[model samples]
Target: MAMAADKPFTLLDRCPPSFEKTAQGVCKLHTRYDQYDSIQGVGVGGLTSSLPARRDGFTPEQIDLGRYLFFDPLLSVDSTHSCASCHQPDKGLSDGLARSVGVSGEEIPRSAPTLWNTAFLTSFFWDARAKTLEEQMLGPLYDAKEMGNNPVQLLASLNANQQYRSMFKQAYPAASDDITLDQIYTALTAFQTSLISLNSRYDQYAHGYHQALNQREIEGLNIFRSFVARCAECHQPPLFTNQQIAVIGTPEPEGMPLDIGAEKTYNAPKLKGGFKVPTLRNIEKTAPYMHSGRFDNLRDTVEFYTKGRGHAVPEGVEMNLHWHIWEPNLQDHELDLLVDFLKTLTDESFMPPVPKDVPSGLTPITHTVQTTTMINHSNSAPGKGE
Candidate 1:
């Protein structure tokens, strides 16, 4: 499942009627899709209208199967944690922790990134380590610190279970009696691609409902787009990300080794400390921020950028000069406005309800009862590091 060295990464090129290509070859989905317009008023378009097309002839049945698998702890070796454990739907598909707690009770090296709008991404993970969603899905399942499922054992477990067997067969009728790892990956990827987030106040404002934003929010939006802050440069419209990694010189967490981010994947020295730019579609819900989760609040994150923290590059790493372009002289009110603008990105409509029970019979990790119990237990501290 590794990405071929010669493979050229590309976004969706198929132009729908709602989108038109500019002279520069960039296709922009108009801010007036009928679907979004119905939700709000006129002028409510999606940020990116790039919906994922079915892969390998996948259908809704397979997506349902993937949804079950995503919540089932049976996918883990210990039957303690599931994909939903860290990527909780209520928490914007990211566990509300500085770093993720794995099945081994050890802290995963990086924060669990939000799965929102992943269907539009060319690369996966904080380091862009995975070239595709299938590759990204396999990384955690096989990681010793994460799900830690042995592939043979995992398949065997599924094969032995009559329920899973029936579900797999239904999901992949062509592969009846032979459920391969590739099918599992495809199903997981399909489920993730279904998690799209494009209904927010900002979306409404961008679309046509100009009154969707109040005076403060409108002022904040102006600040965000203005040259002074220029937040829109990397956090571009629609997807709110350029889908590229940059060395922003984020400091190494205390007592932790320096994470060279995308450099680890490409083996390129110049990419040290660079991480993928994440979408801001659900910024208010997905916190703490950045690759290391250094800032717990939006204000702190904005202040960090205003101070130009990346100006002093680390000893061995090259800095991405784009981080230095932010206007440092922003007043407190303007910063508040900026934070307010980001808050408008939150869209609770994207949150899916946790299934009451999973076929595995293991308590659903996303269940409120289980989550509350886990929070109360000292061993399951949210931010406890490995």
Candidate 2:
């Protein structure tokens, strides 16, 4: 999602309590926009304070409006696939599927990544195609394989709904008479940007709660920081991603289609294999890792890195996959530590509660089992306490 602008706004009562305070000297996981003033690194400048007034850089009305849009099926072509369809709350805000099914019921190519803490993302999309969350919002709606709806048609769909009409008024009083596409994008983006993830086991441990993570997990966290893995270079501490692109050269499955990695970087030709480095937070729950969802389990992911992405073999430099940082033999126990540490990144309370009025007065579109229910409305799932 897009980062909150440097501007300020009043707070909502329903903001996540855990993220309400800005603890100084707490080892910032991510920095502000000016923090990266040196050479164009990730930087943010909005509300980093713990005060509720600016914690999310969004007003209550905007968040409420965005929440409705997030769950609204009207954003889709068939009204069968809302944003929440693939990014389910129970599955760490991710669908936990290697390939997500689209409105047309065709399997999409990449995994549905978690929306939690996406506000800090420097780039959007698996390939880092879209620069801002606002641009990313345009992606699924138009992708033939995803929501499959034209932006104009989707706006008309929302405008036709009476409930949505009321929401637009509450969300944008100044622009109440005319709810344009820009307003829809802004509201939806605000809602998503509000979905921050913190208060995980690691957060407690970082705050000096010694018993937060077990011994094995602690050791694993150390391994993750070690140079052998050099994981922190990309998947850094705190937010767990440096917001930079890396070419891991993940092998494509036998029948999968090929992808070009930043070949569009220049008019020149480029290899079609690279993908963005996703955050490792809530890693244990958001499984089937990687851009193409090639690795099913955490074990395989650790093994991939331990083996230096297959590039660190002796003498045969080209044979080994990750030639940059390859250690010959990392113990199996060490790998276990890395995986255990990663589990501590899970934030159980990341999912927000569905507004009681989201579906009120609106005709609930009956759907099949293939269509996942609104996660915000489901009580059975964990981390749903509003």
lDDT of the structure predicted as candidate 2: 0.61
Could you give candidate 2's per-residue lDDT for residues 86-177 as a string of tens digits? 77766777777766666655556667777877777767777676777778877777776577889778777767655666667766777756
By TM-score, the best candidate is: 1
Task: Tell me the tens digit of each residue's lDDT in model 1 across 1-386.
Answer: 11112322121233322334556443344433333322211122234333332222236555567777898888888777788888888888888887776766666567888887676788888888777888777778877767888899788767666666667777677785877888888878766766756778888877678898999999988887776776766676666776777777766556566676777779887777788878888899989988767789999888767775564456665654445355467888999999999999887674555756666666678621122213222232222111
Off by over 4 Å in 2: 1-56, 265-272, 308-325, 355-386
Q: Which runs in model 1 stand beyond 4 Å of their true positions? A: 1-57, 309-320, 323-327, 367-386
Error of 2 at 356 (Å): 5.4
Question: Which candidate wins on lDDT?
Answer: 1
Overall lDDT per candidate, in order of appearance? 0.68, 0.61
Error of 2 at 196 (Å): 1.0
Estimated TM-score for each candidate: 0.80, 0.77
